[model samples]
Structure formats: C-alpha cells, structure tokens
Target: MQALLALSRAIDRLNTFVGKYSIWLIFAATFISAANAVVRKVFDTSSNGFLEVQWYLFAWSFLIAAGYTLLNREHVRIDVLNSHLPKKVQIWIEILGVILFLTPVCVLIIWLCIPIVAERYATGEMSPNPGGLIRWPVWVALPAGFALLLLQGWSELIKCVAFLKGLGPDPTVKADAKSAEEELVEALRQHQAAAGKAP
Candidate 1:
C-alpha cells in the first residue's frame, strides 16, 4: 500500500509539473495571435503558419492541463445527488468512476491515437494550407494528454482505495484553497479598496 501510495504521489507530481508549465503555452498562443492580427492589419500580410501555431499552442495547453485539472478537483461533476450521499458512498462512486469509465476511455484513446501520430510523423504530414505547420506535433498531443490523464486516473484510484482502508485522507474532499474565480474576485475587491484609500 505504501508503494502504491508513493506511485500515486509521483503521478500527482508529474501532472502538477506539466500543468504548471502548460500555462506558458497559453501566453505564447495569445501573443502570437495578437501579433498575427497586428501584422495582418498593419502590414497587409499574414501567414497560415502563425495562425496554425496559435492553434497548436492552444491545443497543447488545453490537452496537457486536463490531468492537472482533475488533480485539483476542478473537473465538472453533477453532484446534486451524490452530494447528499455518505462519504463512503461518495468515495466508492469515485473509485468506480475512475476504474470503470476514466481508465478505459483514456486507454482506448491513447491506443487509437498512437498509430495516427506515428503515421503523421513518418509521412512528414503537413497542413494543406500554404505555409502551415507539420501535422504530427499537434497529433502527438492526443496520446500524450490521454496518457497523462490515465496516470492521474490511476493515482486517483489509489487514493480512493487508501481512503477506503483508512490509511489516508478522503480523496473526495476538495482542498481548502480558493478557486481561480474566487481569487480573482477577492483581488478585484482589494484593488478597489486600495484605490478608494489612495484617493
């Protein structure tokens, strides 16, 4: 059980690291998009490469951050009924979800995508658009993201089991940290307070 717990922690760390750095991709995409728009309007020129790169970056950020989203318990859930259940029932539901649904779906996607990505890479597939980027780089994200999600699913399953055995904390309970929206609202309030005080 200790070994399994260690493995779970390792998976959590891996997803956390990936998720933290993936935000840079969003910034890169935004910058490239703004630059592309400016260049198109001001210079009367644009390239598909720049536009496609932005798309690629956006895809990478969205795909890679999925496991991290799951880790933070940020994924959408219809807890209207589940919320009323006992803690043990909730944990069991989570375990069943990870085992029966998440794992199989992730594994299937990863399995199906490997050949597609490989073929694209081997063929040096390029976008049909003039001056567009290679296809394989974006294709690779499919399996990579699913693989990360699979690992995180396993980690979550382990945590659920550990909770069942009374060996660790409840996996269903969310951390006490504020969500991004909550933090943003608080920051806005603080800024308003500071501005009022200054004037």
Candidate 2:
C-alpha cells in the first residue's frame, strides 16, 4: 500500500510539474504572437527574429500538454457504445484498446520520429522561412513531447494491469465493513433528529 501510494504521488508530482511549465509555454506563445503582430502592423516592421521564437513556443505549448492531459484523464472518449456494457466488460474493452491501438500508435510515432529528427540534426536542418520571419525547426516538439507521452502511457498501462490484477484503486473501498458501520450510525442519528422534529 505504501509503495503504491508513493508511486502514485511521484507520478502526480511529475505530472504537475509538466502542467505548470506547459502553461507558461502556452501563454508565452500567445503573448508574443499578439504583441508582434500589433507592432508589425502599427510600426510597419517585419517580424523576422521573433517569428522563430513564436514557432518554438507554439510547438512547446501544443505538444507538451499531451502527457498532462493523459495524466488528468481529460482526453475525450467515445463512450456511447461502451456505457451499456458491464463494468468489467468495459474495462476489458479498454484494456484491449490500449494494448492494440493506443500503445502501438504512440510507440510507432516515437519510433519513426526519432530517426527522422536525428536525420534533421545530422544535416543541420534549420527553418525554411528564407526571407520570411521564422526559422521553423520542425523537430523540437516531437521528441520531448512524445517522450513524456510515452512515459505517461506506460504509467497508464501499469494502472490497467493493476486493475486486471484486482489491485488498482478499488471502487469498493467504501463498501468495507468499517464504512458500513459509519453509514449505519449516521443513518440512526439522522432518523433520531427527524423524529425529534416531528413532535
């Protein structure tokens, strides 16, 4: 139990850290782009150097939060069909989906992206904006973001395995004997209070 709690806490802390930093990236991207656009239009200047910075920040903002979203269970799911199934059956479907679809997709993306990015690095790839504004280094976002996502995926896979083992955070913890006793006491107290109010 202690080990489980500790592991959960550590993952939660890491998720929080990523979330906080990713917000700054989002705000920085928004702030700089708006400010630069205003200055460019009003003052008649080209947004050359600042453009690259904005691209990098935009990439950071968009991709880095993926893992955080996974951690929070905030990503959308199509549950219209699954809701009719029994809880255990739903879990089985989810487990198979993760193993067959989600995990493989993430793994394949990272697998392909690593070599692609490395080739860019080896050839000293730079932004192709030419005389435009930003030097768009396309590879910055994928590696870091996907690595965190991979980690998050592994943790969720662990959670699913634990559920299969009948050991993850149990839904029936509140249905234990001690909780039933407390509920009975509370019900009696409430009944007595109601009875007192009657007459």
Candidate 3:
C-alpha cells in the first residue's frame, strides 16, 4: 500500500511537471499564428507550414495536459446527485469510474493511436497541403497523451483506495484550495460589491 501510494505520488508529480510546461505550447502557438498573419499581411506571402505548425502545437498542448487536468480535478462533472451522496459512497463511485471507464477508454485510444503514429512516421507522411508540416508529430500526441491520462487514472485509483482504507486523506477534496471557477466567482462578487458601494 505504501509502495502504491509512492507510485501514485510520482505519477502526480510527473503530470504536474508536464502540465506546467505544456502551457507554454499554447503561447508558442499563439505567437506563431500572430507572426504568420503579420508576415502574410506585410509581405503578401505565407507558408502553410506556419499555419499547420500552430495546430500541431495546440493539439500537443491539449492532449498532453489531460493527465494534469485530471490531477487538478479540473474536468467537468455533473455532480447534482453526487454531491448529496455519502463521502465513502462518492469515493467508491470514483473508484469504479476510474477502473471501469477511464482506464479502458484511455487504453483503447492509446492502443488505436500507436500503430497509426508508427505508420505515419515510417512512411514520412507529409501533409497534403504544399509547404505543410509532417503528420506524425501531431499523430504522436494522441497515444502519448492518452498514456499519460492512463497513468493518472491509476494514480487516482490508488488515492481513492488509500482513502477508503483510512491510510490517507480524502481523495476528493481539492486540498483546501479554491478551484479556478470558485476564485473567479469570488472576484466577480467583490467587484460587484465595490461597484454597489461606489454609488
């Protein structure tokens, strides 16, 4: 159990590190897109490679960050009934979800994508659009991303089991920190209150 928990923590750390760095991919994509537009307008020219590379970066960013998002519990969930359930029941439900749903789906996607990426890479598959980027780089993101997500699902499962055994803290709590949505709502409330008081 201790070994499993340690493995879970390591997976969490790996996802956190990857997620933190993956964010820069978005910025890079944005910069490239803007530069492409400016160059097109100013020089009356453009390369499809520039436009396509932006898509590649965006895809990689979104795909690789799945595990990080899971780690942070940022994924959307319909918790109308869930919130009313007992804590242990909720943990059990999550355990079932990770085991039955998340694991299989991630594994399937990764399995399906790996061969396609390999084929593309071996064939040196270039985009049909002239001056465009290679296809394999973007294709590689699918399996790599899902593999990370699968690891995260296992980590989450471990945490849930540990909690049920009374060997660890609640796995469902957001570690006493407000979520991004909550923080945004509070900021809006404060802004509205200040505005009301100003009048």
Candidate 4:
C-alpha cells in the first residue's frame, strides 16, 4: 500500500511538472502568432511554418496538460448530480469510472496511436504545405498524452482504493485550490479595489 501510494505521488509530481511548464507553450504560441501576423502585414509575406508551429504548440499544451488537469480534479464533471451523492458512493463511482472508462479509453488511444506515430516517423511525414513542419512530432503527442493520462488514471485508482479502505484521505474531497476562472475573477476584484483606493 505504501509502495502504491508512493508511485501515485510520483506520477502526480511528474504530471504537475509537465503541466506547469506546458503553460509556457501558450505564451510562445501567442507570441509567435502575433509575430506572424505583424510580419505578414508589414512585409506582405508569410510562411505556413509559422502558422503551423502555432497550432503545434497549442496542441502540445492542451494534450500534455490533460493528465495534470485530471490530477488536480479539474476535469469537467456533473457536479449537480455528484455533489449530492454520499462520499462512499462518490468514491466507488470514481473507482469504477477510472477502472472501466478512463483506463480503457486511454489504453485504446495509446494502442491505436502507436502505429500511426510510428508510420509518420518512419515515413518522415511532413505537412502538405511547403513550409510547414514535419508531422511526426505532433503525431507523437497522441500516444504520449494518452500515456500520461493512463498513468494518472492508475494513480487516481490507487487513491480511490486507499480512501475506500480507510487508509488515505477522501479522494472525492475538493481541493481548496481555485480554478483559473476563479483566480482571474479574484485578480480583477483586487485590481478594482486598488483603483478605488487610489483616490
């Protein structure tokens, strides 16, 4: 049990690190996109590579952060139905969901994507656009992302089982950490308060 918990914690840390750094990809994508637009407007020219790279970065960020999102319990849920359920029931549902749905789905995706990614790499596939980037890097993300998700699913399953066995904290309990939207709202409120105080 201790070993399992340690493994789960390790997976959590890995996903956390990936998620934190992946956020920078968004800024990179935005900056590149703006730069592309500026160059296109100023020089009356553009490269498909720049546009494609932005898409690649966006995809990388979204796909890589999926496991981290799950780890933080930030994935979308039917809260209206779930919040009213008993804690034990909720834990059971989580266990079942991870075991039955999340695990299988991620596994299947990883399985399917492996061959495709291999083919892309073997063929050295490049985008149809003349200046666009190679296709394999983006193709590889499919299996890589799903593998991370699969690992996180296993971690979540362990936590759920531990909770049910009374050996760990409640897995269903919401963390105190605020959502991005909530954080944004709080920041805006603080800015407004500061402006009012400026007078």
Q: Top TM-score: which candidate number?
A: 3
The 10 consecutive residues of candidate 4 with the worst lDDT sum are 170-179
For candidate 2, the TM-score is 0.72
Q: Give the TM-score of candidate 1.
A: 0.89
Q: Rate the local accuracy (lDDT) of all candidates.
A: 0.94, 0.70, 0.94, 0.91
Error of 3 at 23 (Å): 0.9
Q: How high is the lDDT of residue 95 in model 1?
A: 91
Residue range 36-149, candidate 3, lDDT tens digits: 999999999999999899999999999999999999889998999999999999999999999999999998998898899999999999999989888999999999999999
Residue-wise lDDT of candidate 1 within 103-188, one digit each (tens)?
A: 99999999999999999999999999999999999998899998999999999999999999999998876776777899999999
Model 4, residue pairs in steric clash? none
State the displacement of the C-alpha of residue 40, model 3, in Å, after optimal TM-score superposition: 0.6
Q: Which rank order by TM-score, best down to worst? A: 3, 1, 4, 2
Task: Give a tens-digit lDDT track for model 2, residues 100-164.
Answer: 88778878888888887778778776566654432225575787777777666666655655666
Task: Give the higher-lDDT candidate: 1 or 4.
Answer: 1
Cα deviation of 112 in candidate 1 (Å)?
0.4
Off by over 4 Å in 4: 177-199
TM-score of each: 0.89, 0.72, 0.90, 0.88
Candidate 1, superposed: residue stretches over 4 Å from native: 177-199
lDDT of 4 at 14: 98
Model 4, 1-199: lDDT tens digits are 9999999999999999999999999999999999999999999999999999999999999999999999988998887987788988888889899989999999999989999999999999999998989999998888889899999989999999998888898767556767789999999999999999996
TM-score of predicted structure 4: 0.88
